[model samples]
Target chain A: MLSLEYLQECYGFNHSKWKINGEILDTEKGVKRLTNWTEEKRVRWHVQWRDQLAEKTGCLTNRMIQTIHGERIILSDAGWVTLHDEVTSLFSYKNRENEIGAFFGRYFSLGMQDVDTEINDPYANNKLKIYLQQSFLTKNSTEEMRFLEGIRRESRLRYNKAKEIKEKAGGKQEPIVAPIRSLDQGKVVYGQFYWTNLKGRPEKGYGSLRNVLTEWLQRYGQTSLFSLLNEIDKEFSLKGYHGKNLLAECLTPWEFLEYVMKTRDVHEKDELLVWKEKLTYQWEASRLLVKALGEWLDVAQEKVTV
Target chain B: MTYEQPSSLAFSIKESVWLREGEEIDELLSLALEPDISIREADDQVFIRGSLLLFGEYKPKEQDSNSNSYSDQISFRSVEEVTMSDDGIGMIRHSFPLDVTIPREKINRLEDLYVTVDAFDYELPGKGCIELEANVSVSGIKHERTEEPEDTYDEQQDEESDDYYTRPQEYNDFSSEREEMNERSFHFEAVREAAADDETKDEYESRVEEIKGESKEFQNYERNAAFEQHYEEEDQYEQEENNEEPVSYNTDPEIEPEYEGETEPEPEPEPAPEPELVRSEPTVNFSPQPSPVSAVEETHELEEEGEEEAGRDQTEKSSSSKDENALYLTKMLTKGDQEEFSKLRMCIVQDGESLETIAERYNIQVSNLIRMNRLNEERVAEGQILYIPVKQTPTSKS
Candidate 1:
């Protein structure tokens, strides 16, 4: 909803100089895009991070653009406005997983020291246990109910194991600025993946590689995931803190917890059946992810001896 | 594949190809899944014969053109290197052979041959032409025949040649060899003799100090003279070469000539005439360059320059060279700023013109052209109203 005059005055554009296509401005200088994010600090961090990322790797990111006023974010009637170059070329980690993996691997090696945010504990929420205690006092004889007992037992054991791993990590658990869904192909343009919406998580330690792996599972599945890991391993040497932290995250039973939370408020008997299928499906998917991660760990362990 | 010996001949082949006219390349997906290679030996030289199957997507210049996609099996009977460039809109394919000499020991033991296209690079240097370079390697395996049992062969050879080790009666004849050894001084006697004839330590040290002092004085004199000469020359040069505009110190050769028009040329009052849509053979300028390290600090400073006076000051300093232009686009591309060195100009697609050529002209990507136009495919016809992303100021045609 930015006025044309505002763009002309602030950006030094001649009146009716640039063509507007939705959120993108096709100017003689280059393609400029309007971004939804407005926070100054986060926007600045993104600028710095992407700048450094491009400096380190040949790959470029769609970072925020500065206005003619020497400002990255300008206050306008439609909230704080930020612009970025909209790269629409199709470049994904599909066949080029190694390159994508190498990108993240180099990112991990960059070390996210300046990223300021609270340490997110992946195991901080105990809502699953609370939900199970309240909703499952009696066996409802549903298909989902039959698996709940086993799931609860397994989740408890896995949760404790993760806790133990974190305890071992202790003071060494350094938070990293991790992309929420970096593996998503929709964000990639011209071989540059959008490394935006970064969050700090100490649970996965530096690079937040565990978070990336989980995101990879959700988007790309396990196929060629090892190749991606191998590429990352080549760049960042995902041993010690990165390796152990990722393993710990892999052990977390988020699938079960997510299922419990999804059906937590539902009291109707009929609605439970639909949720049952999803729970079982998520449980199996989570297991496959865990198994794949375990195998990668085993191979990595063998490599240590070699 | 069987070989008589365990040796192989390796061939390194380099080839370059141009994209067909009217078609612009978007991205090279990959080389073909398998390579078809054959090897022949004649006149003590090995010949590698094969075709490289290149898989990629190409955008035709004309909408509704049949050749929307590009996949080619480029055959070659080539020497070590082959380079070809032609002017037209038709697909041009050529091949060369690489002659590999087999070592004498393994010449006759050739068995199996393998070829792989290991490296590739492409450049869209204006025009709808994509210059592709592929580095292919062909190697032949040497087959080794099974040998007779080592012990038996050794025993048989020993029996055949009874003079394996002769116990000579002249074993104690060290006198002949001893004389030569005794004459040669293999120790540090020469060092002792040189040291004996050297100057005294005090004299040497004082001489060293004198030399050092003299050198220092000479260096100081040279430095002062050079500085004075440089300033005097600069004063004279400034007086002689003074113009209305300030001098730019930017010396990047790749960028210097590009912006020569920027500062020198007057803006044309009239819009440029639309270019004819004639199929011009893409000039095969195959120079692959690595992106140089940008002056990021200087760029950040430039970004903070919003005022007109500051802008003039910057223009005086660098005049917005291609590096700066690249940095400018890079900044925009990297989500940095809406700064402008050039403005977008509307361009009409000439005949045999592809998005690649248009992008090259603008120094942008073909994909960007597709995105900016929101075209379903990277196809454009003559007189198509496509926006050139960044029209270079004082525009120079390549």
Candidate 2:
């Protein structure tokens, strides 16, 4: 995505045997990449994050190289361009769970929390009813109808539970600035996890925590979730409001909403099976996330009482 | 609030079974393993069930002269300690121990939950033995159940409800998350029209018959038309609310304006990861990123060394008639210039030496020693002889 001339002029990397391949530029210095983000704030946050992570935890992220103009991001015609010293080789961690947990622990303690707070209505799914109607029209078989009913019932229950939890927690929890790593956003490179090509907007909320934990369970399963939470607890105590907000966020039927929205493009009878499978998978991931969080909170409360 | 959360638990089972007997396994022909697994709950516990199908060629013994092949499809339960062999045809009893806890009270209404078994690392220790090691895992989700009346699609109730209309699509650059989560709605008037067409039954049948003759081409065109229509509709919706909301200034507005200038001074290069402009703390030193080498080249070098090992044993046995004066070098196969010996170097292990140090001393790769000597591991006993490879160059036949 970046030219050799740009790397030479902007970053002072002049190698005779340089070539561009995909998003990376192979130069003598290291692999330089073009990030997918153009937002100045998120880009700045990522640059600083890579620096701090490498400094504190001895983890080598793709550290941004400053241009001749002393800028991390250059405003080119193609948008914001950032050249990083990309670590290409894989680095194996001795204890993957504990080490990954330790890296995240240090990250949570980094004082870069955002102050902007605008709550999104998680229960607002006006399109779901339309999707439900469309599904009924298309898949009118008795068995399919029963399946739809079950899904609808589950969604209603999740919405009510999420509302109840939010009401109980009230506004006691202070939002923390955290990176939202969606399922496709998180990557494992250079022996550690990176929020690769981060597309999620910079935010300060408990939603990011819920999103990250959900992603971990989706990618790494339950053991990683437990170890991650436990290790993060050792550094940044996830005891009171943070814990409650995470629990409430978990109860939000984001999975059902996401899948119901997908029904707009699906028309094939066989595709409904795939649609059902994905919804079920998401539901399972969400349930396990909630269960793990519930168990963790129970243990935390016991420790507090003792 | 006391939330009705799904109970989470874990289980593990390990079982080793004799896959086959009698026939000695000659060569593993093919192994076909698919993770088409299902999870079931019984007696407040969850169990994983799957089948492993393997086909292999065997060396038939003297008594058995009919066939020299064995193909068996074995099915096993994750929880069963003792299981029947498939069809009672073979004597191989396979049962893999499984410890799995599925959160079933609320999320159990579903008929089947697919549990994926990770890729197995299989090994053959001896004849007629297949050892498979794999981790079985069930991962995340949440579902809720309640005793209210079951939800049915009531067309009358839907028509009466005020929430039938879709939201006007608004374009906002900052809130990409919200935009991604936004759903599109379509009216069901098309479905209603198709249903109420009472006078075109014969016309519809004739049209369907005509289309069936060129179904393949029609299907492609129909699929393309649907995609184009969907995209065009999305673009039209986006265009309707072209200027509904300006870019939000909620996120650090001051930072964007500051980056417009090119006057920021670069900090002195330090042995740390701290950027010059950002807030700095006491930095921890990290290892510099290693230079990227082509993984292909490394594997190529390993394969070349393997080829060299195959020819080393014959040369060692043949090179016995060496001159006493030529102390360090010996020539074994100098038939032509192409077959001349370069030189052979050997090292003896001492008390305080490792394979790595010996490699470093002789300026040869450790892999060359291991492959040449056929060493199983990196460790070497004291007073062991380690052969090192010398530089080889092509020579003309003299």
Using TM-score as the measure, the top candidate is 2
* lDDT of candidate 2 over A90-126, digit per residue (tens): 3332236677667666766665554333323333446
Candidate 1 residue-wise lDDT, B1-398, digit = tens: 12253322111111223443323333333333234546566654454434344444432232122221111101111111111112111233333222222322333444545665555555555334433444343333333322223112233443332232221111112111111111111000000001211222334235234322322100000000100000111111111111111101111111111112223211111123333321111110100111122122111111101112222322333333422221211111111111111222334454466889867755666776565454667777653545433321121111
lDDT of 1 by residue, A209-234 (tens): 65577667766777678878888888
Off by over 4 Å in 2: A16-22, A48-58, A88-94, A109-111, A115-146, A173-197, A204-208, A211-224, B1-398
**Worst 10 contiguous positions by lDDT, candidate 2 chain B:** B184-193
lDDT of 2 by residue, B203-272 (tens): 4234334322322101000000100000111111111111111100000000011111122111112222
- Give the Å error, residue A190, model 2: 7.3
Off by over 4 Å in 1: A14-31, A77-79, A115-121, A124-135, A139-150, A169-171, A185-208, A214-223, A267-281, B1-398
